[model samples]
Target: MKIKVNQESCIGCGACAAIAEDLFELNDDGLSQAKVAEVPEEKKEQATEAMEGCPTGAIVSE
Candidate 1:
């Protein structure tokens, strides 16, 4: 699975990064960006959790 962050929709919240440090992080602009273009099989669950936890729904499966 691939995950992508919609910068325009992100509110600079750190929920995604806090939930899955290995999969997401806050960039210089304070927007959350996916650390990996493709999700590892083992991390899909964690990534999904992060996506769900995002208040702005900026994270999406690609």
Candidate 2:
């Protein structure tokens, strides 16, 4: 799975990073960004959780 953060919609709440540190992080702009273009099999569940946990619905799976 591919994960993406919509910068325009992101609020930088850090919930995604908290839920999936290996998959997401706060960038210099303080918005959450996907650490990898594609989610590793081992990290898919956590990534999905992070996506769902995002308050602004900025995280998305492609």
Candidate 3:
């Protein structure tokens, strides 16, 4: 599975970071973006939680 973030819909909320700091980050633009770091299978669950935690509904999965 892969996760994608809609940068425009992100509101700079740190929920994703809170849930999975290794998977997502707040860039210099102050919007949430996925980290370049590879996401392991074990981390996918937290990543999904983080995606769901976004109040702006900015996350998509494929």
User: Which residue runs of candidate 1 sit more than 4 Å off their true CA positions?
Assistant: none
| Residue 12, candidate 2: C-alpha displacement in angstroms | 0.4
Score each candidate by Cα lDDT: 0.93, 0.91, 0.82
Model 2 is weakest, by summed lDDT over 10 consecutive residues, at: 43-52
Q: What is the lDDT of residue 50 in candidate 2?
A: 90
Candidate 1 per-residue lDDT, tens place, 1-62, comes to 99999999999879898889999989999888999999999999999999889998999998
Q: Which candidate wins on lDDT?
A: 1
lDDT, ranked from best to worst: 1, 2, 3
Kindly report which residue pairs in candidate 2 clash with one another.
Answer: none
lDDT by residue (1-62, candidate 3, tens digit) is 67777988988978898888888888899888888445688998897798778898898777
For candidate 1, report its TM-score.
0.96
Model 2, residue 35: C-alpha shift (Å): 0.5
**Shift of residue 55 alpha carbon in model 2, Å:** 0.4
> What TM-scores do the predictions have?
0.96, 0.96, 0.87
In angstroms, give how far residue 25 of model 2 lies from its true place: 0.9
